[model samples]
Target chain A: MERTPPHPEVSAFDLQLVLEALVDPVRRSIVTQLAVTGEDRACGTFDLPVSKSTATHHFKVLREAGLIRQYYVGTSRMNALRRTDMDQAFPGLLDALTTPRAVAR
Target chain B: MERTPPHPEVSAFDLQLVLEALVDPVRRSIVTQLAVTGEDRACGTFDLPVSKSTATHHFKVLREAGLIRQYYVGTSRMNALRRTDMDQAFPGLLDALTTPRAVAR
Candidate 1:
């Protein structure tokens, strides 16, 4: 039997934790991709520029922050944005954070 | 001569930097207070539990992240939320971030 990783309950979502998790560029990119895809993506599907370990760390941060839900599918671990959970906690926060903009910096 | 601190232009606002600044609880509290007050506040006015230096550090973080603007008023430094800039950059992000919540965590 495959064990699922623990994630914070939607009601237990902490704004600070969520913000922290999204602060990193890689994590923000991941969230944006998930938001656009609207589906679970294998961890390896993300075109992260970091090493596998570093990528794993970013996934863990997102999961612990309750920003994403992860589950195992066969040999691959798939991740999806917890959009409903985030919306419940912070309202339009996810949309604002993920909306594409011409970043001046 | 009173010199206003430099802040990233509204068009230059970066989501990652803003999230990084808000990730800190103390900084978040400061932003919340500013949001509620809708006016500039003196640095000494915030009821932060940290040391003066720590509070100063947090303020600098907020200012540099383009989340807030700071300027001198006589001997005191006043800080104000960059609401216009933030909104221009992230739309409803500020409201979502500052809205009072039950915070199940």
Candidate 2:
């Protein structure tokens, strides 16, 4: 069985933490992909240029920040953007942040 | 004579830098205050608990991120939220981010 890392509850999402997690170009890319897909993607699916360790760190940051949720599925850790939670927490934020042209580096 | 530090042009506003600047609680507070006032405010006029140097650092971050504009007026460095630029760059971002309860730490 795959172990799931701890994540913050939607109600406990910290704005600062979320923003910090999304500030990085790589992390923002991850979030943008997830938002665009609108479906949970396996950890290995992202075409991140960073090493495995760095990619793991970015996922951890996003999970801890309550911006993404991770769950195990047949030994694969799948990640999805917590769009509903984000929308509820800060109206229009998810849409603005996920705008491809705006966030694209 | 007061000197205004250089800031990014509106067209050059970058999402990563803007989000990074707003991720800090103190910086968010400064932006929030400026948004609420809807007018330019002197740096010293903010009731920040941090030391002058620290506050200055935060202001610099905001300015460099293109989230705020700072201008010199009679030796006072007045700061104002770059609402127009932000709105044009990332529609609805400033309003969502400046919502008091949402970004309040």
Candidate 3:
């Protein structure tokens, strides 16, 4: 897998990267999974219907956007939502994006 | 001087486009200016230091990302923040992003 060194220019308000990173339903699903589990999960753990290549692409987008942090923990790349960074940057923006809508039965 | 017709696939939650469009400080300045003015502004009105071409490109990015609505209202194109649409999609997100932080002297 590819890794990018941190750039000082990348700040919390990099809105385009943030937006583009989260545009996919699958990525949203991943976020929800992280939130629900309340813990970081390995990149391979997500049961996405798409192929591994697509999953890798989504993870890369999220990582590049600074929404999630990925690092090698053994052979697996563990992923965790960068809640603290996001909350500090935009403060409550992530909560709005991930809130579950009430469904009427 | 190009206009894109409305597309059904264009939803407010298209996060990548939204993030990319707002990444530029000039665009954020435009949004803040729109918020401060509390009214729609013409494309030519924003006194950005950048060239007019760059301003137009920024506007196009915002428009494509569904962050702002643009329409011709005479010779100039009028622009307004799509606050309502953003609220519906990710309620309270814009407020968080645009909130003025308290500074102590």
Query: Which candidate ranks first by lDDT, i.e. highest?
Result: 2
Q: On lDDT, who's better, 1 or 2?
A: 2
Report how closely model 2 matches the true complex, as a DockQ value. Answer: 0.73
Q: CA lDDT of each candidate?
A: 0.84, 0.86, 0.71
How do these models rank on DockQ, best leading? 2, 1, 3
DockQ of 3: 0.25
Model 1 docking grade: medium
Best by TM-score: 2
Model 2 spans > 4 angstroms off: none
Off by over 4 Å in 3: A1-20, A23-29, A48-66, A71-73, A101-105, B1-20, B23-26, B49-61, B101-105
* Tens-digit per-residue lDDT, B30-98, candidate 2: 999999989999999998989999999999999999988988888788898889888998898888888
Clashing residue pairs, backbone N/CA/C < 3 A, model 3: A15-B19, A16-B19, A16-B20, A19-B15, A19-B16, A19-B19, A20-B16
Q: Write one digit per residue (lDDT tens) for candidate 1, span B1-105.
A: 438767778766766677878878888889999998899999999999899999989999999989889988888999999898888778888888777762223
Whose lDDT is higher: candidate 2's or candidate 3's? 2
Model 1 chain B worst lDDT run, 10 consecutive residues = B96-105
Candidate 1 positional error at B77, Å: 1.2
lDDT minimum window of 10 residues, candidate 3 chain A: A4-13
